[model samples]
Target: MYTTVELVRGSSKLADEKAMSAADVEMYIKKAQARIDARLKKRYRVPLAEPVPDIIESIATDFAAGFAIEKYYSQRPGKEEPYLAEVLIKRAEADLAEVLEEHLLDGLPGVEFLPPPGPAPAVLARPAMQSTTPVRSEMTAALERW
Candidate 1:
């Protein structure tokens, strides 16, 4: 379960808005949770109840922050509004979608194996000659009579 502070601080940085009150942050998060839940249910197998996974909460936090910030900007437009930032809420949503999509990829069939640690062993071959054999030094002479 997200407390007032969790919802606010978790997403404030991403929203780039520090002036919003905790109440405002909480209000937006609660409003955004329904949409987040629906999206999560469609995209992942995770439960949407309280005590949500960190990853889900993370993206939800981002979404909540963006929702609140956009509302804030709409209500009070300014030159430094987050809506004008290059990394907008859409980028965050896209990144989160990619992250969640990985869970689906994890179960797919063709998993690759790592290569062997060291170099491959060398192969040895024997001489191909039919009658040729190497001679070894060994004393095998018989004694001769005088």
Candidate 2:
């Protein structure tokens, strides 16, 4: 039962971390887009220019790298920093998603909306623990008695 609780906690932390990473990526993309817009208006003197997709992708990659680091640090026993960061990430991602949707759909009509940030890919590979006795042995014995 304790192990189950720990697993649940770990899963929750993982979810939070992924969400935070997504938000950070979104923020970096937004700021980069703003800068690009400013530059185009002041220097290039263009009335309107779309932000480059490559810039957003680069920022997303950097955010993922940061998440990887957090995951690494979280492996230390009794450390909660990583878990806290994970929760913060979820809030950030939700906020960023709303902002992105508003900006992207400002002028477009009849366009389907983009999906918000989804689950993050598993970064750490956990080796399955091997035990001689089956975990469900008691349950199996009970069913046999029935």
Highest-scoring model, TM-score:
1
Candidate 1 per-residue C-alpha lDDT over 1-146 given as tens digits, one digit per residue, 9 for 90 to 100:
32244664555553344666777777767755665555555544433445555554665666676776676666665746565322445765775677556763243333222344565544435445563446532432223321
> Residue 3 in model 2: shift from native, Å?
37
Predicted model with the maximum lDDT: 1
Give the distance in Å from residue 143's predicted Cα in candidate 1 to where it truly belongs. Answer: 99
TM-score of each: 0.50, 0.27
Q: What would the per-residue lDDT of candidate 2 be over residues 44-138, giving only the tens digit for each residue?
A: 22223234233233333333333443555656775575665455444435543543554533443332333555676565455667768746678
Q: For model 2, which pairs clash?
A: 16-86, 17-86, 19-89, 20-89
Against the reference, the lDDT scores of all candidates come to 0.54, 0.41
